[model samples]
Target: MPDLPILLIVVVGIALVFDFTNGAHDSANAIATIVSTKVLSPLTAVLMAGALNLLGAFLGESVAHTIGSGIVQPEMVAGSQGLVLAALLGAIFWNLLTWYLGIPSSSSHALIGGLIGAAVAYGGWDAPLYGSIGAKVIVPLLLSPLAGFLSGYLLMVLLSWLVVRSTPGRVNFLFKKLQIVSSAFMATSHGLNDAQKTMGIITLALFTFHEIPEMAVPFWVKLACALAMGLGTASGGWKIVKTMGHKIFKLEPIHGFAAETAAAAVICTASAMGAPISTTHTISTTVIGVGASKRLSAVRWGVAGRLVVAWVLTIPAAALVSALCYWFLAVTGLAV
Candidate 1:
C-alpha cells in the first residue's frame, strides 16, 4: 500500500456521500409500489429494500467497471482533486435538487455528466473516454427506458389476459403477496446497478492517485459503496415514492407486481451487461407501461411529461454545473 493523502481520504468520503444520496433517492424505485398498494408498510418496505440492496451489491462488479473507465480517465483526472471534487459536487447537488423537487432523476447520469464537464474543463477537447460515454452512457440512457416500457407493457398485457377470468378481488389478493417478492427483486437489482457506480468512481480515484496502477475496484470499495447506498435506501424518500408509485400510474397490487418485475428484469440485465442504466428511468417507464396496459387514461401524461423533461435535462444540467465548477477551480489556480 502507498501513503494515502488527505485528499484521497476526502474523495472517498465524498464518494460515499454520493452513494448514500443515490440509495436514498432511488429507494423509491424499489418500494414505491409495494408501499403504495398497502402490500407492505413503509418501514417494512424500506428495510427490505435496504437489506436487499446491500445483498445485491455483492452480486456484480460490471457496472462499477463500466463507470471506472467509461467516462473519464482516472489517471488523467487524479492529480486534480479540485476537478474530481467539482464533479462530485455537481452530481451531489443535482441529486439533492431532484429529490427535493420530488422528481426522479438519474443519479448515474448526473455523475457521468459531471465527469464529462470536469474532463472537458481539465482536458479541453482532449477529454479521455468521450467515445465511451456516447456508446455506454448516452445510448443506454435513451434505450433502457424504451426497453423497460415495452417489457412492462407486454408483461402486464400478458398477465392481465391470463387473469382476465379471475375476480378483481381475487387477483388483487394474489398480487398483493406477489408485490412483496417483486419489491425485493427490484431493490436487489437497484443495488446491483446503482451501488456499482460509486464503486467505480472511488476506484477511479484510487487509480488516479496511483494507489493502484489499474482501475480495478477493490473489495473494500465495493463494500463501502454498497453499505452507503443501503443505508440511504433504509432512510428512504417518500416524496419521490409518491411520484413513482402514484403519479406515473395508478398502481394496484397487480400493476405494482408487473411494473416491479419488468423493471427488475431490465435493470438486472443491464447490470450484467456492464451498462449503468438508471433505475429511475427503468422503473418509471415500466410503471408507465403498466399504466397504459389498463388504459391510456390511467397514465398521467402531464406528470409523465414533467419527468421526461427532468430526464432530458439531467445530463446537460450536471455537466454545465461541473464545467462551471472546474472553471472556477482553474481560474483560481487551485486545479491541482
Candidate 2:
C-alpha cells in the first residue's frame, strides 16, 4: 500500500472532484426553468444559483451525517481507503456520462450506489447496512419526487384559479417577477441537499485514515465542499439544461415558478430529514406535473420516458462501475 497520508490526499481530492461534477451536472435543476422562461438570463441565473448553493451548504449537516455513517459500515471499510476512492470514481464517471448524454440522472443515487458497491466489494454482502439504506435513502428517493409532482400540480392549479380573471399578459408579467424568487429558493435547496454528499464522503475518508476520531464533518471539509459545488455551478451545464429546460415541457414563467417552488419545498424538507434526495428528479417531475396540470398533452411523455429510464438505471449502473473499480484496486494491491 502507498503511504497513508498520500492515499488520504488522493481520496479527498477525488471526492472534491465528484462534488464539482455534481454541481455542474445538477446546476440545471435550479436554473433551467427560469432560463427557459426568460425570467432570467442564463448568466445571471447560474450566478445567483451558484451563490445561493454555497449558502445552502452551510445550512445543515444532517444529510452529511447520513452520508458518512448511515449507508455503509464505517468500521468495515475503515482501513480500505481504496473502497472510498473507487466509490467516488464510480460516481464521477456516472455524472460525466449523464452530463454528456444530457440526461438529468440522480447524482445522489449514484453516490449511494457507488458506496454500496465498493463496500460490498471490500467486505462481501455484510458490508452495507441495507435496512438503513432502505429506510433513509430509498424511501426518500422514491417519495420526494412523488411529493414534488403532487405539490407542483396542486400549486399550478391554485395559481391558475387565482389568476382566472386576469389577462394572460398580466399573469405572465406577474409570474416572470415571481419566478426569480422561486429560482433562488430552488438553487439554495439544491446546494443544501447535494453538496453535503461530498462532505459525508470526505468525512468518511478522514475517518478511514484516522485523521478524525469520528464521522463528523469538520468545518474545513464543509467549506471546501461548498466552494467546489459553488464553482462548479458557476461553470454551467448547457447540455443537460437544454434537455431539462425545453424537452420534457415547455415552461412558461408561471409554470417555472410553480415547479421551482414545489421542488424546493420537497428538497428542503428531505435535507432536514437527512435524506439525500435528488434535486434533479424533484425539479424534473415538478415540471412534468406543472405541464400536466395545464393539459396532459402539454408534457412530452416521450422525453420524460427517456429521463425515467436513465433515472432507474443510475443506481445499478454506478454500482457496477464502483464494484469494478474496487476489484481493480484490490487486484493492484492498492486496497490498504
Clash pairs for candidate 1: none
The per-model lDDT (C-alpha) reads: 0.90, 0.93
The local lDDT score (0 to 100) that residue 149 gets in candidate 2 is 87
Model 1: per-residue Cα lDDT over 153-216, one tens digit each: 9999999999999999999999999899999999999999999999998888777777887888
Give the Cα RMSD of candidate 1. Answer: 2.0
CA lDDT, candidate 1, residue 94: 98
lDDT of 2 by residue, 1-336 (tens): 799999899999999899989999999999999999988999999999999999999999999999999999998888787988999989999999999999999999999999999999889999999999998988987888789889999999999999999999999999999999999999999999999999999999899888998998899999999999998998899999999899999989999999999999999999999999999999999999999999999999999999889888998899999999999998998885
Global lDDT for candidate 2?
A: 0.93
Query: In model 1, which range of ten residues has the least summed lDDT?
Result: 1-10
Per-prediction CA RMSD (Å): 2.0, 0.7
TM-score of each: 0.97, 0.99
